[model samples]
Target: MTSHNRRKVRLITALAVGTSLLGLAACSSGLTAAPSDSSAMSSPKAGGNLRVGIVGGSAKDSLDAHSPVTHPDQARVIQLYDTLVSYDNDHKVQMALADKVTPSADATTWTVHLRAGLKFSDGKPITAEDVLFTFKRITDPASPMATATSLATLKRDEMTAPDAQTAVFTFSAPFATFPDIAAQYAAGIVPTGYDPKKPVSSGPFVLESFSPGQQSVFVKNPNYWRAGQPYLDKVTIIDFPDDTARVNALLGGQVDAIDQLPLGQVNVVKANPAIKVLESSTGSWLPFTMRVDQEPFNDPKVRQAFRLIVDRKQMVDQVLGGHGTVGNDMYAPLDACYPNNVPQRNQDIAKAKSLLAEAGKSNLSVDLVTSSAAAGLVESAQVFAEQAKAAGVTVNVKKVDPGEFYGDQYLKRTFSQDFWFTRDYLPQTSNSGFANSPYNETHWDDKAWSDLVAKAQATTDEAARCDLIKAAQEIEFDRGGYIIWGFPNSVDAHSASVNGLTPDKSGIPLTSYGFRNAWLAQ
Candidate 1:
């Protein structure tokens, strides 16, 4: 994997929701106004009870931060742990538990200054040994909870924590975005000796008790580096497998906060006098990611034609209920790096047919595989089928169990000519759509395209990196390896009393809800 891909992968790929209910009328931007050096609401007053609920629970796959990919697990980490660095509301990196950070002259070498007298909730000191052990374990292939693949671009080097307050990292190359990478939950600092079943973290709250398929409880961490923080003495994170149940819990006042409110329920919540719905555009993309290694998809024209048939507006309007911003050609529209003038994919039946004919293809009948569990996903599949048919393509919609789809089936079928609809971030999805480079999930390997992605991921210069990412994005857009339908603003509902909610570029916008600066409306 190139540093370019790794740069994007530094972010999480999950839709985050909170499970607590407060009286919120409209869900505005959840941003923290703390100075660059501090979180605004950090008064260090740690005590009180906060009950939150999540729409769905996490599966067993990819829970390890090193190899982790699942949303629930990512959210879990963000909720219970703290990274060395974190992002402000504007996507800028900020200090979290660390007191200060100093990067080397080459940007490849860096050091973290941990706050003094810090300790995990378990009462163990947050020592440099813990930081060293955590990184070492994550880079190790055998660490049970390791999610190392996310850091594949980096050469394995030694991490040294000379003292409890200082952690140093030496990289193989100049990584300008290293600060951003530190904000990822996968990079969250764990207990010196992390135990999977018995977990401990140097964060605001302590995992008092955990249940595999049920509720997990968090208690305030008095030793939290930030003094007098974690206002809520106890936080109950209940897992409601269904969004409705989660919503119902919120409406009935069974929970204080709720995450993952269904897209269709936006109106219901807006109409409800007692409920509050917060909405914003997410950096996440719901696209028809095609594997380029397979037959038919190997031709960029063929892929472009298929994407042309998609009625993106309809997906955002009818299927999404007009609550989201349509992703214009690129995977995400709001990211700072998107190219504005790129040609968009309009629903052109005639053009699609012509392109298909140019490819000298068959009657164009293929299976559109997707998970039925994801909200609005089934409706999206049906709509795309109708749209593609207008351009002489027949889509056989198949509802595969998400578990199977994400497993070996996705990689094998994706690279071998099978088509599927999956949710992912635009930058990471770019790699998955083509198989040019080694990690290409679609196995669509093009040397030129690979080179662009490689440059985009590794180039230390900001302007240079942006240009390369844009070029790679254009290549994918022009050729049609990804049929990005839309980049809908995600809606996450929290009680009006709940404070300090912020959204990050990463889809999991549930961080920053510590409520230390958030009072229960005295």
Candidate 2:
């Protein structure tokens, strides 16, 4: 057995034994304790409106909770609606609207039990019927939402709400990790007749006013389920598309917090004792996507040559400003199933040249499309262009506007860049790994790889699922079109007076922009 397999065996054994101890602790406490983070130090005091500065927003932003396309949209959605489940600081799944979610023995069916007395901001009781409605709209064939990809296996016709508080979902195939999917940021629950124009929230806050690309204002939800939560009277999220203005907003005391702090400004911000910077290690990445079906990259040797030509270490150090770890041409470094045992791929100029020559492209030139949409994309592309010169390759870096980059030519580009937040292996793959993936920028499509992913998703046993996932990862490591060079840290900042902002591995800054727990210290 490999070291990865051995680790899985030990983990399963430990989980089996730990269940008894967990039961004992629950019995003693009369409830299962929620996971806690030690990063939050002081007690919270309430009653101040918090203003947060977020990066990147355009007029294309929408109030639709299910299809948030910008950082500001995502931040607003989290406040206006609650997902069934969410990731805590450590990236473990935790209950939100649903108190408990139980899977059937075969992992094909799931039952969700909502917390008693839950109500929408408008005072209507939150019910399973609403949950069913929300999901139905999300998976509607004619107009599916962003989360439809994650729920592709869901058997929409078999869904049922047998009681006001209980919802049942049946899938076309076994889905052992439904909770993780439920925790997606875009999977916010809504009412039966929900309207984006006039929203009813089940979350800690209710939308008061919004302006696309400008700002959004929210008021505390009086009917919020969590006790004494959403301590603030209001929240205001302002969009500062420019990094300099965003950082300045915090320094000037115009905003209480800011998300996606520029790596170049980390030292400058840290030097200010009045400000507190929270840094969390994340699985987030910005990869150079090479279309497998296109010229130059269509040949396996050419793909291999490009992969070897990248100086992963140099990119991580210079492009990320030493705020990240090197990537080995694979994603989901934080996932348990990630094949860490695979030998790390590094720059080999001689080998890259040889491979290029073998592919009859001894002197190759390619256009690398990139944009300033995300924080390090353009710089990474430029750095990579410089590094490719060592392997007899002339890389032409083409910078496009953020809006134009993700516009009509998004997935159609033969070579481009894309950004992703930290997600587990299966969910991440569902978005970008398959033939029909909505964001499959690389255009990678292989039956063998897809079959392995399907088997892994269907496997109820954790160890067996991980084994299948490792095998799939190995295939991608060998021939995948992504040149994943690094995983950057999520750096966010807030005023010293702000409490409850802690490090979160979700890669969304400020604990997935969870201002519900944040309060102004007196």
Candidate 3:
């Protein structure tokens, strides 16, 4: 291999390890609530037409509680469905069907008390039975919720209800982050034995109709428990298949709000007087995934070598248009558990070459697989390939249908490198996304790293957990499960007249349309 290619290989290896350990030290690990900007959330307007945008078709393919694998159609379903608990714009967990939460003295068990009077969109009193049913189906052994890991650690048989309005959970272990799991979409509620295809829920909006790949309408639920809420009477969600198309739709006044904007043009909307931007930090980063079971990647030295070559700051500046923070190779600096003093890799070509030589190989060539929808990943992949070539490694960059990119064909097939966007607290991220065998699809297993993660999670001591998490991140970055580039400040832009839009607590856009509390200014 040329000296240039060898240099890049070394960078890939070193940076991958260096960043994971120290990257998150600067990250904000504390939970942030949704922005309560007066312009976005205040008093309710009661009723109006709220038009929104969807990036792709809202996957109306199924509404069964078993479905909801994507976010496209969730806004439609959120109008009709309700989890036992919900989060207000501020990200604070609030009682939904349940009134109060009381955990047993040991904290391993939690009893949820339901609000007295509530009804599903179908007018059925949303009793505790419905909540139990919804929980059971998703947690059933026959079902493997794509998003299961978010709520997987719980023991299913441990959930019981004393009566209709109250359910109790006895855990197999004490988990400090239990409540956080309840707020995810996969835990959405449906009636017992309800067909997984047709869903029923208790929330502010109801799915009126869906036209595949076009638009879906959600009508306000008059019986919604949130009084004086769901300000708008109807929400028309238009699907914009192309990124520019969505922006164009917003500019043309055909839609009032859109969730996505190309990274370069975020400034365009900021410059426009008509739009408002809301953004927050997230535990998400562009990951260069190496299935450790495969050749070259299976060898830690090779993986670490390639990882070292990545220039995190450069990737952030070039690919994200300078709106994001440079990734340090782990999850994000926001993860409290990330270490304060782990090694950070610098782009040193000689070091990369030496590492590759140590791995008993000289020539390195591989196909870099990327998804079509991940424009950022594709652009970054090209940059990575170009940089690796300079380090004496030839990278064949290939774009594949994103639909199948994460499936068995890509996960278990011929692809060598893949891009993955990860979201969640740092510790959970380390265990599920990077750890192997039962949780990690990449199958990377390290005894010491796993032990650190376990201690961090089981303890309620925030400071200790943070320290442990930081150590685990070190292991991940140094060992070469991934090379995280950075975290970008993600925001959604909308017409200024489309007042009352803010970033949600989780760094996602506020897409649900019953924002009767939000209205267009005259």
Candidate 4:
């Protein structure tokens, strides 16, 4: 046997001793409802068109299911296409279109079984060939999809559709967390002859009309795989780039609900009583990213000094309006494998100065690029600038337009701030912390960290994987480039007329933008 096969055999033998194999089977059910006090709410009655106002959209919006760059895009795509699996309010993997996904003994291969009698919006059968085609399209080099980085280890040549109901995928290494990957929003399935302009829906809604940066109208999919779902006859996602306009639309009854409710307007909307606010505690964070490959940050001491200069509690109180928990310079606070034992990092101005002095960079001054991209990003940057003065460091806060902030210089900026929703440890790291992560703003690439993640991914035992993940997290704690100050609560608002909207830990408002379950009260 090859060395990789030999290693897999040994791992299987060792894991079999006391741990069950990593074969997870999700029930063939629709999305689960988030925990809510629905005792007094009236039963859902179908037929009205639900309009939702969301922040952030531009002329660059797209209908591509594999890549959704903005809130509106994500909201629309999830309604238009279906992935094999999805996450519930607690961020647990739940089966969507697939009946069950099973892994091999060594976790190097995964077999997917589609739910029988599934059909697209056009009444075409959803076979295993469609699943294989979607994955191949995602990994195609000629046109790289957004989920390509996450599925980099997928062996394209080894993928096969054994029959109409079964599709098998082989990976280069043991991917015990393949289920989580399959649950990604960007991994939505598409038919073989898929055309972006004339999209086929495997989800609750079918696109009727789409105008980038303005609105997307979708009618209910009568053939949706889920039974008795999509209570609304239509869903209209309207993009309001300005927060004020979005909230006003909701209050003015122009829209049924709004996502990303500004912190300042939470009480204003609550006082009306005509609207109800939905709040979900999440692992989401807006972090200051320091590029480690560049000067000033290239030195480990400089990076540590920057991390030590932040007052996390103050950031949480002032910027988040006391709506979040303090962070410890790490992401994925809700991950099962999060290293809770790691000491919380508190601001130490004296130590920060000493570290800067040792790096021969005392009285350091750096421009902190920020924007009003999200609710608290610019405010946090301003707060951090004031706090850095205690360490004798000058943080020059430079505010930019939201559009320009995410433009060409987004990841290239020396020091900037960015936002992220709640994600588990491995998936979160794959997008932002790994060497080839497309959004690796810090440019942190460490072999030790990478190896630890690989081992954790291969390990089947939950406890063993947790141990490996903790070890990797410790390395990041010492030298990672992100100054994660706090995790803000996801806040959304909806008209009292709207029901079925529940809190979700995934950090996406309106139950991870789940419009399928929502219905308007007559």
At residue 323, give the lDDT of candidate 2: 87
lDDT of 4 at 121: 92
State the lDDT of candidate 4 residue by residue for 1-522, as single tens digits.
Answer: 000000000000011111233433232322232233232345778899999997777776777777666677778778888878776666666677886677777778888888889999999999999998999987788776766666778998789999998899999987777767677777778888899788999888999999988999999999987777788899999988788889989988999999889988988999998999999898788889999999899999999999999999999989888989999988878776788888899999999999999999998999999976677988899899999999998999998865567566867899998878877777666677777665777999999999998787778777888898889888888998888989999889999989888777877757353588788888
Model 4 ranges off by over 4 Å:
1-42, 511-513
Per-candidate TM-scores read: 0.82, 0.92, 0.83, 0.91
Off by over 4 Å in 2: 1-39, 511-513
For model 1, residues 1-522, the per-residue Cα lDDT tens digits are 111112113253221111010101112311112344333444434355667776444344322334433334444565566777665454455567775666555556667787678788778888777877777776664542223433445555577778778878877765444554455555678876577566676777667776644676777777777655656677777766566788888888888777657887878877876666766555555666576657677777788788778788888997778866676556545445667778776788788888889998647887877663345666778888888777878888876654445445655554212211112223354435344221344455566767776555455555666677678778767765667677656567777656555544444455443434433432
lDDT of 3 at 30: 17
Model 4 error, position 370 (Å): 1.7
Per-model RMSD to reference: 7.7, 6.0, 8.0, 6.3
Better of 2 and 3 by TM-score: 2
Tell me model 4's lDDT, rounded to 2 decimals.
Answer: 0.78
Q: What TM-score does model 4 achieve against the real structure?
A: 0.91
Model 1: weakest 10-residue lDDT segment is 16-25
lDDT by candidate, in order shown: 0.58, 0.78, 0.58, 0.78
Question: Clash pairs of candidate 4?
Answer: none
| Local accuracy of candidate 2 as per-residue lDDT tens digits, 200-306 | 99888999998987999999999997887888899999988788889999999999999888888889999999999989888888888999999988988998988
Q: Write out the backbone clash pairs for model 2.
A: none
